[model samples]
Target: MPSHETTPAESVWDYPRPPALQRDPRRIVVECAGQILADTTGALKIMETSHPPVFYVPPGDVRTDLLRASSHHTWCEWKGRADFWDILVGSDIRALAAWSYSDPRPPYEDLVGHFAFYAGRVDRCTVDGYTVRPQEGDFYGGWITPEVRGPFKGGTHTHGW
Candidate 1:
């Protein structure tokens, strides 16, 4: 058993309905499918209620050559339409492992073409050298580092919240 107590610096419940986007200068790295997928210190982080921070890495920092665009698309009330990106390395193909918004809603225009990944769908994710724990459950692609405590929403019984 693990301790669940926290004196959190930020609470997901306190996050705004519209979410807040900010430039995060910490080193973010993703290694998956036996490849170094992306790395950058110039990522933007999105904070929303009941979710861990979602870091969006600029395209220039990613291995764009390894990505194959997927026809799949989903709508986010705040971020506008999102297009899924599949990772292709040799014969391995990971579907819908990452997402990008080529044209974001007004508040998130800075995120255009930035890649946000699902840690659970990949091998590993890290922030400033601390290994990241993917937000529980499947839908949300949040990065949970040591600093952020949460009653995160992606786990069981936390849906539609």
Candidate 2:
């Protein structure tokens, strides 16, 4: 396991290996091309070791019309297969900018149909009004906020972890 000094903030190194989900009451807002795609307080945050949290927003709080199904699909050993979605804001399109597990396996079944966006791919992603930095790497969707500390795993050198 990676070792780092612990402060008052939560450390990514201490997160569980298989990941765990928790309700996040903070407002999560996603915007692109001056349009709001998702705004919700009813989000579930998944925490995993060496990674920032990935917030899953409920479908009811998102603009369903702006999301178009994409051809991309990926499998997670823990969460099962994920389906991708492209975000369209007027003429601007970000292909496979979001994803969700439409039929997740046990323990992650609550995530079915809940969407998680790529913070770097969107114009902006905010948690409780604080802008979030996207987790490094194209495949991971974790969002790094001020309260979460990491020498995170998704970057090039850390992939071997």
Candidate 3:
């Protein structure tokens, strides 16, 4: 009957590897719209955002061929140097749909040189086999990882999504 509950295994409040972000660096991939971009196992899922999770994958894992450098940029107090990328879809190019950390501050060195994509710009986004829906009003995907459960965006429980 409680709106919130905790399990011995895990909970949103406490993550096992808190500060040090670890990426599988195996066979992780992301696809959006009809574009099959980013195919690398080595990706770091940073927990800097609380409402939704954001993942930063190395540029090598990302399909840079379809990406265009953008003038737009955002800064994080913890992380450093957030660069933006525009996605090229045929004749149309979406602006500021992707970002990367050219230089990162201490404690977030692993995320350095890695990039994160904005789910909102793409028609669709997927990780492994599960489909991820972009978070509203933000650049994040809630469905690319295994840590999520029910009541996700686009789910039956999500009336607003």
Candidate 4:
């Protein structure tokens, strides 16, 4: 478990809108195609209302050499534009498995150069040794930890949420 956890489990409903970014000390390890995609104890989490926290690993901690920039892009009202990456491993190419805000908007600039992977796309993702459940649906990338309470965004009929 992460020693930095100072409070009880958090309810996503209590997370603020526009989101909040805070440094996290928990060990985060992600695996994909039987490879260690990323490993870090220094991570950041983006918390938003109705959503579990999204963990972002610093670019330096990720296996960037195994990732390629893809043409896919997305826009977020809070984080601005994000670019996707495809994971290339041993004759296998996983498309759009990771994303980063190469140039995030103000307030979210700290996320620039950091990468967040889709838990469902990767073989597995663990926080403090606990495997995470990917946020429902394909549109979001929140990692559902036991410490998070959610009526989370994503899944069917949550488009306007």
> Candidate 3, residues 1-161: lDDT per residue as tens digits?
22222412223234333434666543455665577777766777764323345667787777888988889777766776688888886787878888887788888887876777777776655555445556545533433344443333333345454
Writing each residue's lDDT as its tens digit, candidate 4 over 1-161 gives 54536648899999999899999998999999999999999999999999888999999999999999999999999899989999999898989999999889989889989999999999999999889999998877999997898788898988897
lDDT of 2 at 133: 97
Candidate 1 residue lDDT tens string, 1-161: 22324424777778787999999998899998888999999999999988999999999999999899999999999998999999988988889999999999998999999999999888889887778899998788898876676889999998867
Each prediction's whole-model lDDT (CA):
0.89, 0.92, 0.62, 0.92
TM per candidate comes to 0.92, 0.94, 0.72, 0.94
Deviation of model 4 at 72, angstroms: 0.6
Steric clashes per prediction? 0, 0, 5, 0
lDDT of 1: 0.89
Stretch of 10 with least lDDT, candidate 1: 1-10
Tens digit of lDDT per residue, candidate 2, span 14-59?
Answer: 9997999899998999998899999999999999999999999999
131, model 4: CA deviation in Å?
0.3
Worst 10 residues of 4 by lDDT: 1-10
Q: What is the lDDT of residue 59 in candidate 3?
A: 77
